[model samples]
Target: LEKAGIEIDRKVLADIASADPTAFKAIADKARAALA
Candidate 1:
């Protein structure tokens, strides 16, 4: 997100992501697409 000029709490995001890896990948892909 930083590369995309988006600011978010990495630690908080990491915590939330660790809860569900599958969801994390999906969300990550979406974020990448949006950033792209």
Candidate 2:
């Protein structure tokens, strides 16, 4: 996220993600796809 100028701690992000896996995975997949 820092690469995109967003500042979020990894663990904090993980905790948030764990709270809503379906939503997080969709967005996370898109973000990872961007790297590809």
Candidate 3:
């Protein structure tokens, strides 16, 4: 994400990645939107 210039809390992201894939996708979509 850093390479994309999006900064998120690592632990929170990890939790989302492991426990809440829906949220992880949401976050990734949001980040992609931000980049666009």
> If scored against the real structure, what TM-score would every candidate get?
0.50, 0.50, 0.69
Model number with the top TM-score: 3
Question: Best lDDT goes to which candidate?
Answer: 3
| lDDT string, candidate 2, 1-36, tens digits | 555444568887788698988867776776676667
lDDT of each: 0.71, 0.70, 0.83
Summarize candidate 3's per-residue lDDT along 1-36 as a digit string, tens digits.
Answer: 665676788987998899989989988987887778
Alpha carbon lDDT at 11, candidate 2 = 85
**Candidate 1, RMSD to the unseen true structure:** 2.9
Candidate 3 regions exceeding 4 Å error are 1-7
RMSD of each: 2.9, 2.3, 2.9
- In Å, residue 32's CA in model 3 sits off its true spot by 0.6
Candidate 1 lDDT over residue span 1-36, tens digit each: 665454658886697688878866776776797777
Clashing residue pairs found in predicted model 3: none
For residue 19, model 1's alpha carbon misses the true position, in angstroms, by 2.0
